[model samples]
Target: MTATPDIVPPTEVRMAEIVFPNHTNHMGTLFGGQALAWMDKAAFLAAARYSRRAVVTARSDQVDFKLPISVGQMVETVGRIVEVGRSSMKVEVELIAEDLHTGERKLCTRGHFVMIALDENHHPTAVPALPADIAGP
Candidate 1:
């Protein structure tokens, strides 16, 4: 009898970007749209990594901007798969801002994104179930 090797997939993805003048708004803080774009990209990468398949954003939910991220600050975005279905995954993404000189960090924004795995034909495709040990609510 042949045994199937257990393969654990990645559940999280992190990306970093430095806030620049062009990325800010008139108030000198990061723009809401730019933040959303970054969060979506992080979610896409996390879902793709977990599923090992092409993925697309299905929706974004409850994005809250808690703090202002000023220009010159470093932003670190993290995405983690929280829920998984046959063809979709819910990823929780957070953006943290850190002052380069002071090293002070704070959570600036948080949101949840739903991503759907897609096949070559652009139809929904099944994804592997998350490991029980790391599965989220």
Candidate 2:
């Protein structure tokens, strides 16, 4: 069985965002758990795009909190399907905070999410190869 490549091209990355609010905070900054949740969601979306099937988080690797996201800031999550196996995908996801008015960007957190493709019965299923152009150099 051939393993998927370790890297995926930047173009394959999918980006999404949500505005921060008081309720999304714990200490005047976006909560770490909230960031993790969004990262997982974005990773799942990226993995599903290639798997063409339902995917669920099987693991998270080395989640690092590098900066703080403040209220009214837009939290943008970028996710990419980096590696694939018989039934699993490794998605690299980054969380960034953007100034709403100025559009400035800062990376807040980054992590790798391992997702498994699921069949109709919710059992693990195989994932197809990513297109050549979308794959890494």
Candidate 3:
């Protein structure tokens, strides 16, 4: 759906995925590449939902995997637009791994992804400004 000027960051996109065995590596932890893919997807969805246009991942920076995400945990990715440019949206995507039985939550990774909105012709296009009061995660 198209987003209007009143759209807030938190309302853009929030996704949760279970860390199944298939998502883990032989080390029994979530794979780094998979985590990055999820983060990028979260950012793309947030940007597209807000801009109501096709969007592409431009760049990701400062990705830090603070802790290992174990299998059988719940991975929640919260994406919010941090800033707006002519056609680029800077989004902060935070990954939180939660233990279902123990109720323990840990910050796994946090990264900033820049997504560029595209027009029907696939050219860069403008996007609405993020609400001033909305804070990044």
Winning candidate number (TM-score): 1
Winner of 1 and 2 under lDDT: 1
What lDDT score belongs to each candidate, Candidate 1 first? 0.97, 0.81, 0.89
Sorted by TM-score (best first), the order is 1, 3, 2
Q: What is the total number of backbone clashes in candidate 1?
A: 0
| Candidate 2, backbone clash total | 0
Provide TM-scores for the models.
0.94, 0.82, 0.89
- Clashing residue pairs found in predicted model 2: none
Across 46-95, the per-residue lDDT of candidate 2 in tens digits comes to 88876779989999999999988887888778888877789998898998
Candidate 1 vs 3: which has more lDDT: 1
For model 3, the run of ten residues with the poorest summed lDDT? 3-12
Compute the lDDT of residue 106 as modeled in candidate 2.
Answer: 94
Can you rank all candidates by lDDT, best first?
Answer: 1, 3, 2
Local accuracy of candidate 1 as per-residue lDDT tens digits, 64-114: 999999999999999999999999999999999999999999999999999
Better of 1 and 2 by TM-score: 1
